[model samples]
Target: MKPHLTLPIAIATALALAACSAAEPPAPAEPPVATETPATPMPADPMPATPANPSVGGAAMDAGKDIVTNASAAPNLSTLVAAVKAADLVATLQGAGPFTVFAPTDDAFAKLPAGTVDGLLKPEMKADLAGLLTYHVVAGNVDAAALTQQIEVGGGSATLTTVQGAILTAMSDGAGGITLTDGKGGTAKVTTADVRQSNGVVHVIDSVLMPK
Candidate 1:
């Protein structure tokens, strides 16, 4: 009993040979720790996708967002956005109600007459290029302060009526701005008018409107 301290039998044979040299089989199970994969979500935006408005080959279609959207017109009329897409007239200037476009920028087709905007963007003259572009449209809704008070009480003048019906006058250039005769007289001045659309109004003329 006094020697029972045989060191607890030499520490239980050194803890059974150190648990059989730390059992080498337990390490192979650690390979299950590698996981990372979860990321993908971004895509949704495109309709009339708005880079601007107007359709059909979209040739600068900027007739004041089709007169503010009266229905869908867009003939920013100049030498004609490539003759209104070569006469397709962008779905009849976006059809539906109230149309009043006097637009014409790009320096108003650079004041044509020289090859008249490439001869009305040829192609059998697309119905004379959409009848000289719906003769600069005018089915209704003529704004711009009632066209500058009807061109100052008619002294300056202010008449309109097209859709091919013809009869566009709207003059008044003592400085104020306004001019748009066409029925073969071809004038165009407006040089930027009301430009409100959604029903019609763009008066940004300069020239390029002849139809008689």
Candidate 2:
């Protein structure tokens, strides 16, 4: 009986050992699956800049505005503006004309004989004032670069026909400046150049240009 009992106990022990060996050893703790961190993103490129408009007569000259509007805003161009209004040329200048205007400042008008401006502003002198004012204007948009090119092509001097039916001579003043000779043989120097307007361009002069 004792031998039989010993054989049964041995069999039971062997069965328990086989069951333990077959069981998975807790999957080896899964090796702690390494969590990869996400990568950072990069930035984009910048844009190009635009050019700014130039200033005039202690005021900002807007390239979006017309010649009459711009001239009316300038502190030094008040006399010229008044003359334009008196001469009934506001409509003409404000029209769609890519004109080139040789604008004279208040100081330039002051250089004339005393009471000359006042006399011209009178109602009777309207036609005369209009003629004088129109003498400073050309048909198309002639900027400084175009004028310079014309000067170079015309043997150092260029003849510009004004809207007033008169010719004005443009030449280099031998000192890196432009000098304009009117129909009356008087000379005016360009103090400010390339003052761009929506309907035209302006070159401010030290003296007023006159017609015959």
Candidate 3:
């Protein structure tokens, strides 16, 4: 009876130990190590660069634009632009040939006699208007530096043949400026020089040049 009782006691103890082992709860699962995601970097602002060309008529001039396109943007050139349109010379001024333009300001156009611009803009006077406007344009891109060099080379004056088939006399104004004498002896001083464009360069003049 005593030996049976001892064996029973041993079996009960073994079962209790097995139950305790099962209740241990997997060592708390190591607390799930938190992996932090890296933060995203922000982008920088995109700023535009400054343009190299100077402003004209209170508007910024872009060197990538052609002559007619640039001239149309200038406030001081509205009269000249209208005259060009009336003369049907927009296509010619916008052409591929590198033209040198002596651009006249609105004040320059105002110096003409009353009704001169209106008269020239008429349909019947298209040929005359075209001829008169072409007098302000030379065949090639003659910048201020080149014109100065030409004047120096020709002993203080240079002759420029216009697209209007007339001769223009370029001379130094004795004060580091250029003066253009038209065929009719009217003189125009270059107020602003070296206004660069895609197709050519322009020198803003205070007076309109005329052909003979």
Highest TM-score against the true fold, candidate: 2
Q: In candidate 2, what are the lDDT values of residues 1-212, reduced to their tens digit?
A: 46769988999999999999888475655568788889776666666664455676888888888989999989999999999999999998888898999999999999999999999999999999999999999999998789988999999999999999899999998887899999889999999888888898899999999887
Give the 10-residue window scoring lowest on summed lDDT in candidate 1. Answer: 50-59
Q: Pick the candidate with the highest lDDT.
A: 3
Give all candidates' CA lDDT scores: 0.66, 0.91, 0.92
CA displacement after TM-score superposition, residue 7 of candidate 3 (Å): 86
Sequence-dependent TM-score of model 3: 0.75
lDDT of 3 by residue, 38-104 (tens): 9988888778884467778989888888899999999999999999999999998898879999999
What's the lDDT for residue 41 in model 3?
Answer: 82
Q: How would you order the candidates by lDDT, starting with the best?
A: 3, 2, 1
For model 3, the local distance difference test gives 0.92
Write the candidate numbers in order of decreasing TM-score: 2, 3, 1
Clashes of 3: 0
Which is superior by lDDT, 1 or 3? 3
Backbone collisions counted per model: 7, 0, 0
Question: Which residue pairs show collisions in model 1?
Answer: 67-197, 67-198, 68-197, 68-198, 69-198, 70-198, 70-199
Give stretches of model 3 more than 4 Å off: 1-51
Would you list the clashing residue pairs of candidate 2? Answer: none
